[model samples]
Target: MTTTFGATSTTDEVLQGVDLSGKRVLVTGVSAGLGVETARTLAAHGAKVVGAARDLAKAERATSEARAGAANGGSLELIELDLASLKSVRACADALVADGRPFDVVIANAGVMRTPFGHTEDGFETQFGTNHLGHFVFVNRIASLIAPGGRLVNVSSAGHRYSDVDLDDPNFERTPYEPMVSYGRSKTANILFAVEFDRRHKSRGVRATALHPGGIPTELARHMEPGEIERMLEQINAQAATEGQPPFQWKTVSQGSATSVWAAFVGQADEVGGRYCENCHVSSVTDGTIGIISEGVRRYALDPEHAKALWAKSEEMVGERF
Candidate 1:
């Protein structure tokens, strides 16, 4: 059946009439926003949702609603994961693997947005290290634990349109550092990670994809200066106006998280595997300088050669081969 959903669809709407009994999902960033919403929907629909976060107390508080509303054998569990640190990432992955319970879906949703320049515990650029490399090491480490026909959903962003991954200088050592540039490179890496992961695992009945949750006013923007988001919205709206399009509207948490649910469960595996998605469907490739207002994936983000190169580079950086 063709999907009846669009940009305005909510998680509740997307999961309507669906039963997730026996499904097991792991969602990162469960402390707030899209992660909580995604886990809530999955658990409410009878799926066992394992939530990972850096802050256990915060996550326990944040996921109370999901735990309270859980139904039909559905439940939520929490595990500590500090994606900013390689030691933490590996430990988390190792513990999960040792448990031997297979996950039906793994959503790499935790990430940092535009922030003042810094490096992670491992000394990589903060955004790239936390958002991309961390998950890269974690997921690939536990890849064997994903059940056949499982899905890996990497939560990327529309900001990927801002730049492609610079394999030569991933740490901004030689180039000027812009917040969005780093964010873009990281988000693009998220997509490329999915592309290559899907390629390697699809033959085993595992499919991976990346998606943008649309713009939502969540804690992801806490690092931004006051008025930064507002100014960006104005610019987006101005660009939309010039293009004869509706003004850019921020998505509610539900609306923002709908696509993740769609891609994880509702969408066809064949259609979405190895693709970049937004607005509840696979995105078409497009070229533009509309900032984040552009509505499609860049071709380079899904290039097979690029994805392969990234995979190799990632292995080298992490000092581990998948």
Candidate 2:
């Protein structure tokens, strides 16, 4: 029988009865929102959690909040990591490696959303660069230290359903860039990256998963205009109210993070790899539709040929290898 979890399930619900003592977890974007919630829940259950954030100060604040909520939150550490730059990624990884700690779970939870056109330190499109390639490079740097039987959870988004990866001109080199398109492209890459990484690394006891955290009114969308946010909420509310079905909707932060927590510790997910999930199950892929189809992965996202090509191109672009 296939079991399904929902957007309303909290991390505590997903982690109930799970023992994570002695396990080491690294969570990015842990300063606030879903990332903080994910970290707090994991640590409360006994996992040694290192909360990495772009801002150390904010991370410290998050740590205090997490500690207040966790029975075993002493393990939470705030590490500096800026996903917008390779240099920053390397520095963070180097420090972690220096600590000589092995991580049992690496949650790529940090990401940027729809924002005006911008570029990274390497001059790539901002949303695509930080949300995808930045994490890509950092994952490679830390792959060796990831526990052999560890899980790598890449927090992707359903916005991926908005568009597929653009190979011809990913960086808007030849074409004009659109904010939403760039966000969608990056989310798509997050899925494909997991597919390829799991394919290559599962043999070594490393598995990767990509998942949509469900729609939540997270700070990631802070860059968008107020009207844009309202419009989005209106659309989701309208869709849900009209459908009477589950709203196909956005979840609260705890609810949004439940699936990722489940994926990290669920017994059923232990050997599962290279799949995209939402609402705590393998997400259904619907063609030209906003709703899920109920089974199988996205064709373009899992295209082995494209995965390999993207891997190669990414390596060349970052001058790094896994």
Candidate 3:
């Protein structure tokens, strides 16, 4: 029987009856928000979860609550990871590889939201570099360690509707940089990366998927100025008006994490892989337009050709091949 979980479902609810004993899972951005809840839920189900973050001390503190709540044989470990730095990504990947532990699931759940225009240490646009490229390099470097039947879940966003990747000017070198636009491009890249990664790796029994973890008031918005936040709320209300729907509601962290946990553990790879999920199910494809409160994914975000192109571009930018 198919169990349908909804947007309000919590991680524990979505994972009901699921057994994760002996499962080795990796979750990024576990310092707070949805990441913390995701790791806690997985660990509470007997999964040995490694939580990766930019700050080990912060992660330890943030996840201490999770460790206290662990059930069965569940456990949490912290590892240092700074997605904006290529050197850090490489080192993290190398450390995981050296550990010689195969992972059943890898959730790239950490990300930066709309921020002032800036560049990563590698000189790429900050959002794109940290959100997409960092995970791209990390995943590719550690791809071999994913056990057969393993899953990769990229935590994307509905904000992808705001813009698609600008292949030629990804760094905003020629075009003017808009913070939300850059964020949209990066989120779109997250879905596209999953698409291509699934296409290429499915033959090896590894599947990939992406999802929008719903709108939650998390530290992800810490960088947004008050004016930007107001502007975003105005856009959301305007979009809601057009859709004839209620204004967007903020999801609790548990609700925001349900889809990622569900995608990681509850479904068949062949069925869920390469799809974009929201509200705990595969999302429909919609016209690519800017609508912050829209329900479906944009067509361009799921384009296989764009996925392949992004893969190539990512390889070039990272100075490596997957």
Best-fitting candidate, scored by lDDT: 1
lDDT of 2: 0.81
In candidate 3, position 300 carries an lDDT of: 92
Deviation in angstroms for 314 in model 1? 0.8
What local lDDT score does residue 34 receive in model 1, on the 0 to 100 scale?
95
Pairwise lDDT winner, candidates 1 and 2: 1
lDDT of 3: 0.92
**Per-model TM-score on C-alpha atoms:** 0.98, 0.92, 0.97
Query: Which structure is stronger by TM-score: 2 or 3?
Result: 3
- Candidate 1 residue lDDT tens string, 7-56: 99999999999999999999999999999999999999999999999999
- lDDT per model vs. reference: 0.93, 0.81, 0.92
Alpha-carbon RMSD to native, per candidate: 0.9, 2.5, 1.3
Residue pairs in collision within model 2 = 284-294
Measured with C-alpha atoms, the lDDT of residue 69 in candidate 1 is 97
Candidate 3 worst ten-residue window by lDDT: 286-295
Candidate 2 on 1-322: residue-level lDDT in tens? 5445665778888887778888999999988898999988888898888888999888788668776665643367788899998899999988887888899999999999987888999888999899999999888888888988898999988778767888778888987888888988898898889889998888988899888877687788888886986776667666656656454455788898898888787835444488887777776555644533222345677677888888887887788777
